[model samples]
Target: MTTQRPETERQAPVRVFWAPGCSSCLRTKEFLKKRGIAFVSVNVKDDTGAREQLLALGARSVPIVARGERFVYAQSNADIVGFLGLEETAAEMLPPAVLVERLDRVLHAAARYLKQVPEAELDVVFNDFFAPRALAQHAFRVAEAFVEATETGEDYTYERMMRGTHDVGPGDDILGYGASVIAALDAWWQHCPDRSCSAPLRAYWGVQSRHELLERAAWHSAQHTRQLQSIVEHFGGLPDGPLGERELAGLPLPDSVWMEASADA
Candidate 1:
């Protein structure tokens, strides 16, 4: 006989695929238990069916978190930390207006950091595929797609965003493009403040909502902020930031969705 959770506890669907001796798996379990959140636990090591299920879900690792149909195979406990929704100062706790304002500030800060990069280094490749222009263009595109999804309630696909704009470049107006991106994000949060208001996300990304997008936008720019700092370091330029040493060292990095999107790429 199976026991059912109280209706209130059943509202949010959460599951964990875990294995013994996996610290992250243990942390995820403890995280849910401490928060009074009801969740299904699957021990992939002890249960054959559980292992099969994890593989079927495209997870090769333990400590996979599933919020409804969305799955995050974490490299560290910090990667899935946003799902807690409990931190008082977290973006999820911010009022809609403030949240939108924060995105604008991040965009402006990124533009400022980009401007500090030497003109000659703009064309220098930092990683395998990203440079200053590619990174800025990506942020602009992501904001643009999210804004459209907010307005139309239609799922925005990567293919669709690339169709007409594939050949378009950022030109020499990186800051100007960033302003438009920030404006669109502001409009999105203003019109869609209710955390429950959700539209379909592109299946390729995962099942997601406006709430998830907001969290993503916050983390996304932070990732670029780190990258920009690296670029500054390479160019022997000082990257300015408000974060202190310990806080900067402890910054939580988002799980790279690029790994999951590789098949599509």
Candidate 2:
């Protein structure tokens, strides 16, 4: 006769069976951490019980994720991304208020991070591709285009702000630019006649809805903030800021915001 393991009460939203030195497992943990998704990490290599648990689930791979009684062996980041519903789809159906509120949180968070960039390093190109000044300008352009396309029903041809030849500004411009973005978002949110009103607007990148545009902007800002964080870390490690692990975990936003990809189209 075959023996079976009885089910137990779920103590967390997610449980990951992982092993040290496994790159995929590390990535899985980082993915959950990035989204503030609380999970119990079971190290299969160190604990006999955890190893047994993984085998019992019929999973031979590390980074096996469990939600409730169901288990899935993640083959790649895409698997986990899909399982977490991290892909943005059908956002046009969400309420306008929700979109606006999420956009506010993300925009403000990005600004807060950029504001802390040391003034002396603003013009120093980190990668020969982006400098603090260029990043700030790019952020402003994203917000500007969103408002322009939405209010006028015009096709805003999106370009790669990352690799553009933009005029340099004072390192402090990030502050005013961030404020403008927030103001524009507020106005757009207030005047949006209905959720369906902006559905017809299409960005040059082929994005079909205004909601997706806003969602993309939020993710884009956060991404650039991460880039700035890396630069700061290289300089001499970060000195306590919004991009800190704890602060990032507490940022308020809709759960679906993580699924909203910043990619064009």
Candidate 3:
């Protein structure tokens, strides 16, 4: 007889699994709080064996919503609503063309901020998972990953986005990567036959239209760019062209710089 894993419990009280420097995690956390849904939040970034628990539950990334052993990737607000039985409608999204413009502004701003980071601070870990330099790189990577999805039509996996957080050093090298991603985004749009981006693509959270994902890409990177601006201030240097309300007008960004104060809430 073959041994089998136990059945997953689907109706249990909610448990949220998350890590630092994750945009989706922050969004999911905020959404739940705004809805007044009580949940136990677990920070896998600084906790021992918490990551192992996620692996056991078959989740390959952070921002996982678990009910006992059954978990869903909390990447899409719509998916979270369906999984938790919430009555909600998807928010009206900005057009892909507008989102592209927003992404351009965010990426350029992030590149400028990253180029100012000192080499000495490259390895300094802000939390257990990410460094000061990695934060800026992550901001760029989130946008790059979205473009990668458009080009490859593949599921936006966590590993693909976080793969290079440690590979590049501070300053020029990171800026180069961001420049490449910006170029790629422009090229893809110029050549794309459909500006609407109506085709659906598989993302870790749920199946979302290319247009929907574009908005995600724009706001996702913007959130990290906001964090990068704060880090620039921490290093006693003013960030060039810091994003303000005009740049961040429509993005659904959270106020907290890092993860929320209470990861256990």
Best by TM-score: 3
Best-fitting candidate, scored by lDDT: 3
- What tens digits encode model 3's per-residue C-alpha lDDT throughout 32-52? 999999898788877788899
- Model 2 shows how many backbone clashes? 1
Worst ten in a row by lDDT for model 2: 256-265
TM-score of 3: 0.86
- Tell me the spans in candidate 2 whose CA falls farther than 4 Å from its real position: 1-96, 159-165, 170-172, 196-198, 237-265
Clashing pairs in 1: none
Model 3: weakest 10-residue lDDT segment is: 1-10
Q: Where does candidate 3 clash, by residue pair?
A: none
lDDT of 2 at 19: 63
Pick the winner on TM-score between candidates 1 and 2. Answer: 1
Q: Model 1 — which ten-residue stretch has the worst lDDT?
A: 256-265
Q: TM-score of each candidate?
A: 0.54, 0.51, 0.86
Superposed on all Cα atoms, model 3 deviates from the true structure by an RMSD in Å of: 4.4
For model 2, residues 139-258, the per-residue Cα lDDT tens digits are 556666777778887875644333232666554465776688689878877877866545766554244567656555554555555566656666774534544333233222222221
Model 3 spans with C-alpha error above 4 angstroms: 1-11, 127-129, 170-172, 260-262
The candidate with the higher TM-score, 2 or 3, is: 3
Cα lDDT of model 1 by residue, 1-265, tens digit:
0134455543666778876533345445665565676777777766668878887777666678765445776433334555444453422334434445555665666777788888876755555435676566555665566677667767755454433333435455767877887777766666665645454454234456565555445545555655666677778887766323322222233333121111110
Score residue 217 of candidate 3 by CA lDDT.
82
